[model samples]
Target chain A: MALEGELAAMMAAAQRGDAAAYRALLKACLPVVAGIARAQGVRGEAVDDVVQDTLMTVHAARASYDPARPFLPWLGAITRRRAIDRLRRAGRRPVEVHDPLAFEAEADPGPAPGAHLETRERGAALARAVAALPEGQRQAVEHLGLRELSLEETAALTGRTKGALKVNLHRAIKALRASLTREGE
Target chain B: MAARHEQLVEDLAGRLAPVRPLPRPGLRAAAWLGAALLLGAVLAMRFAAVGMEGQAPADFQLAMVGALLTAIAAAYAAFVTSVPGRPVGWALLPLPPAALWLGASGLGCLRAWVSPIPDLHGEHEAVGCLGFLVCVSIPLSLLIVAMLRRACPLRPNLTAALAGLAVAAAAATLLAPFHPHDTALVDIFTHAVVVAGVIGVNVLAGGRLLTRG
Candidate 1:
C-alpha cells in the first residue's frame, strides 16, 4: 500500500536522525498503535497507556528494524507486546467485585429513603452478571473475587494453574465492568 | 492524554541523534562465528601440544562437525531473534545440529561400553577438560552477548539462551581436536553439565542485560 511505503520512508529518514521525520512518524504511529491495543482487547484509558509504552519501545528498538522489510509488522509486534504487558500487570492486581463479600459495619445507619432499594437492585444486577459469565470466568470471579481466596488456593480448588486463574480473573473483570457500565448508561 | 502523547513524541524526537543500524543478522552471525573459529583454532593448537596421541575416531570427527554446525546455526539464530519482530522460530535452528552432536557423542559412549577398554584419562585429566570447557566458554559467551545487546530483543531470555548454546557448542568443538580422552560417559556428562550451566547463566544474566528497561 502507498501508506505503508510512506510510513517506511518516514521511518528510514527517522533512522537517520531527521527530527521532523521522526516526529511525523511517531505522531502517525499513535492511532495505529491505539487501534492495535483495542484489537488485542485492551480497553478504556489503558489503551492510551499501551500506545505510549509501544512508542517508547519502538524508539528504543528502532535500530533493530530492517529497512528492507515492511515496517507495519514490526510496529504491530511491539504494540502487541506492550498491550500484553499491560494486560498481565492488570491481571496481577486485585480486581474489585460488585457483590458484598465483606462488610465493615458502621455504627451509623448507611443511607436514607430508597438507598437500600437501589443497593439491592445493583447487587441483583451484579449477581445476574456473574451468573452470565462463561464457566472459567465465573469460577475465577467466585474463587478469586467473591471468596477472596489466594491465587494458590484458587488454583488448588479449581485445578487451574495460578497463571490461568489470573488470566480468567482479568477477562471476567473486564467483562463485568463493560456490562455494568452499559447497564448504568 | 492527547497533550501527553504530543509531548512524548516531541521529547523523543528532540532526543534523537544520528544512529547506525545494526548489520544484517547473517552478517553479524558470521562475524561472531569468525571470532569463535579463530579462538577455536588457537586453542586446538595449544591443546595438541600436550594432549594424548591417537587418531580421533570417526564418531569424534562427526561430533566435531555437528558442534561446528551447531555453533553457526545457533549464533545466527541468536542474532535473528535479537531483532524485534523476527520469527521466534529462528531460535530452533540449532536443534538439528545439536541433536547430531549429542547423538554422535552418545555413540562414542556406547562403543566404549561394548568394548571395555582402560579409561582414556585419569580423573584429574577429566577435571582439566571441564575447566577448559568452562574457561573457553566464558569469553565466547560474553562476546556474543555483547553483540546481542546492540539490538533490542523482545524475548531476551530466548535470545540469550541461543547465544549461550552457540558459545558452548563452539568451545566444545574446540575441545574435540585435542581432547586428551576419548568421548565416554564421563566426558559426555561433563560437557552436558557445562553446557547447561552456561545456558542457565546466560538466561539469568544476559537476559537482564539485553532488556532495555
Candidate 2:
C-alpha cells in the first residue's frame, strides 16, 4: 500500500512535469532496469546507454501509462527491448564454454545450512571474476549465462553466426571458471 | 571532493533523462487531421446510407454511429499516448470527443435492447453485428499499426501489420456478441482470422522493406 501510494504520487508529480519526481522515479528504478539489461548479457559502456535509452522511452511514453496497472511489467518490457537493441548494434559473437562451476550454480538448489559460508564465498568469487572479464568477453558471458539467450538469438543480435558466438562464449566461461577456481584454492 | 558519489548519481540521473521533446510539427497535425477525416467519413456514410434506404428512420442508427466514432477516437488517443516522443497534450485531447461518442451510443443501444419493438430479423441483426465488428476492427487495427510503427526498429510496417492483425482478432473476440447461428459463428471466425492473416502479411512485407539496406 505504501509503495502504491508513493508510485501514484510520483506519477502525479511526473505528469505535472516535475523534474525532481522524474529523476527520483528513474533513480529508484535504475537498479532493476540495469539488472534486467545485464541479465540479458548487455555489458560495459553499453549498459548505461541501454538503461538511459529505456528511461527515455519510458519518460516520453509516460502519459500512456495507466496508473491502475502495475509498473514493473511495463518497465521490464522496455528494458528487454532496449537490451535486444544494444545486442543487435554490437554484433557480438556467442561462445560455447562448458563451465562446470557455472552449470553447478544453476543445477544446485538452495545452499545447505553449513554450506552457506561456502556459497557466499563462491558467489563473491564469481562476482569478482565477472567484474574482471575483458569488456567484450564479460558481455558474452552475461548474455549467455545470465540472460539465457539461445545461440540463435545471441548470434542474430550480435551479427555473429552460431559457431562464432559459441567460441566466444566458451572462452569467456573458461576464463570465469579459472578465476573462480583460483579464488577457491 | 567529498560530494563525488552524489555528483556521480546526479550525473547519471541527468544523462538518463528523456532527451527528445514531444514531436510537435507535422506528425501531431497529421494524426489529428487523420482522426477528424475518419470520423467525418464514418458519420457521412452512415447518414447517407440511412437516407437512401427510404424506411422509417431508426433512432438506433445514430446511437450506433456515435458509439463507434467515440470508441475509435478513444482508441486513437490511446495509440497517441503509446507512441514514443508523443506529448501528453495529445492524450486528453481525444478523450472528450470520445466520451461524447460513447455516451450517445450507450444510450441508443440500451434503448433499443429494452424497447417493446419487434425483434430484429435474423438477417438484419447479423448484418448489424457484422457492421459493428468491421467498424471496431478497422480503427483498432490501424491503432495497432501506428503503435508498431513507432516501436519496431527493424521493420516498422511489417510489425505494425502483424500487430494490427493480433489486435483485430483480440478485439473481435471481446467485443462481438456471440450468437448460436452457424452462419454467425462462421462469419465471426472468418472475419477474425482473415484480419489477423492480412495484418501479419502486411507487417512482414513492411519489415522487409524497411530493413532493406
- lDDT (0 to 1) per candidate: 0.88, 0.55
Cα lDDT tens digits for candidate 2, B97-155: 43453354455455555653444345665565556556655665555455434432232
Model 1, residue A35: C-alpha shift (Å): 1.2
What candidate 2 gets wrong by more than 4 Å, as runs, is: A1-5, A92-185, B1-159, B166-213
Per-residue error for A175 in candidate 1, Å, reads 54
lDDT assessment of candidate 1 = 0.88
Candidate 1, residue A115: Cα displacement in angstroms equals: 11
lDDT over C-alpha atoms for residue B73 of model 2: 45
User: Using lDDT as the measure, which candidate wins?
Assistant: 1
Report, to 2 decimal places, the DockQ of model 2. 0.03
DockQ of each: 0.47, 0.03
